[model samples]
Target: MSDYFHNKRIVVTGGAGFLGAYILKGLQDRGCGHILVPRIEDYDLVRPADIERMYDDMQPDVVIHLAAVVGGIGANREHPGEFFYKNLMMGVQLIEQARLRGIEKFVAIGTICAYPKFTPVPFKEQDLWIGYPEETNAPYGLAKKMLLVQSQAYRQEYGFNSIFLLPVNLYGPGDNFSPASSHVIPALIKKCVDARDSGADHIECWGTGKASREFIYAADAAEGILLATERYNGPEPVNIGAGFEIAIKDLAEKIV
Candidate 1:
């Protein structure tokens, strides 16, 4: 916890959410004095007017845009348009308003889903645009990817201080466990727990079990974001991950 965040007014858009909870704890641990977390009921960020209002009310020195429309593959498939539109609108409007407000810094959190469907074993930041994202989450991925473009463009044109970070799938305590929207780890955890409680022979997992993924504990990912916010300020996007991949079958077996 450097003095970098101390005495600076901060606004974390999704400070009440899963990852957002860890972020808030980190900020408080780092001694941030004033932190604002606008609830959805109070600020519907998808609307430009609400964004403007949030800026007026919070008057944040650093804006960490983390609020997003997110879910599992089933949700993505069922509501691609909703995911794309809300995420894009929230990010674009928030970044534009932050620039206009002349904030000290803006940190935009991106998704690993933005990586192309068949990225090399070790995902590299430079290879972000080489190909299309996996089909199930493409709309959500592309919407978030736009922030990287906007961050670079804003820095180049308006000299606005902003950074984008791509974090692999995050899993840790207090993660979303709902079957309807949970990611891989939590979904698996729930299934395993339920099977054990019921004394079932086995549990069923989604997909072919051949898909591989890398995940970062939510706390570690939060810490990385705070570090990047305090120190790093470059146009190129950064990757926050554990740097290892596990096949779904292997991951499930381990969890079991």
Candidate 2:
């Protein structure tokens, strides 16, 4: 890749998270130095004042907005309001502050859940607004999707350089594996591993196993984000994903 990222002062929100960790290392691999990763304890991005303080303190050349309140379907079901409010507030405040600071670039990471429930397989970027997202993930999805709106409006009104990325279900190392919070791949890995140890005949799975999803490995997703930041600049939202899909039942069977 190009050395455009060399020595740029960048801030990666949620830099300690599952995908964020890979993104951080990916940035490092791209020779990005002066990277500032704020811990939640030290910097509360949801607060406008703190966001202001961060820009004043770091004066980063770029901001990758990845911090979000997210979880599995169950967690989303239990905390829709929290998911909606926190993600909305965080993305809104951060992007606005980045604009105010005249930051050179802003990368906003969105979710696959932003797509409508019945979106055509191998979900495309243009289909994002065809209908409401699946009921279980609507709140979190809409909250992240709003970043695309924010990016467009900012570009139109102020020429702010911001890009929004929608990556499909992410898996691989560092992903959550707990039943309460894990996505499909990690959850299934845990289930299978534990079942093997426990000598179980079979494992119960969620749904009818009819639903299918596309997955982007964390490392590959990180690479895509880095490349987008370095090269892609446009108004249309982009989909970052592997061009393959899998049925949940088939995935589980393969896992076992």
Number of clashes recorded per candidate: 0, 0
Tell me how candidate 2 scores on lDDT: 0.91
Give stretches of model 2 more than 4 Å off: none
List candidate 1 stretches off by more than 4 Å.
none
* Model 2 residue-pair collision total: 0
User: lDDT (CA) for every model shown?
Assistant: 0.94, 0.91
TM-scores for all predictions: 0.98, 0.98
Tens digits of lDDT, candidate 1, 137-221: 9999999999999999999999999999998999999999999999999999999999989999799987799989999999999
C-alpha lDDT (0 to 100) for residue 67 of candidate 1: 91
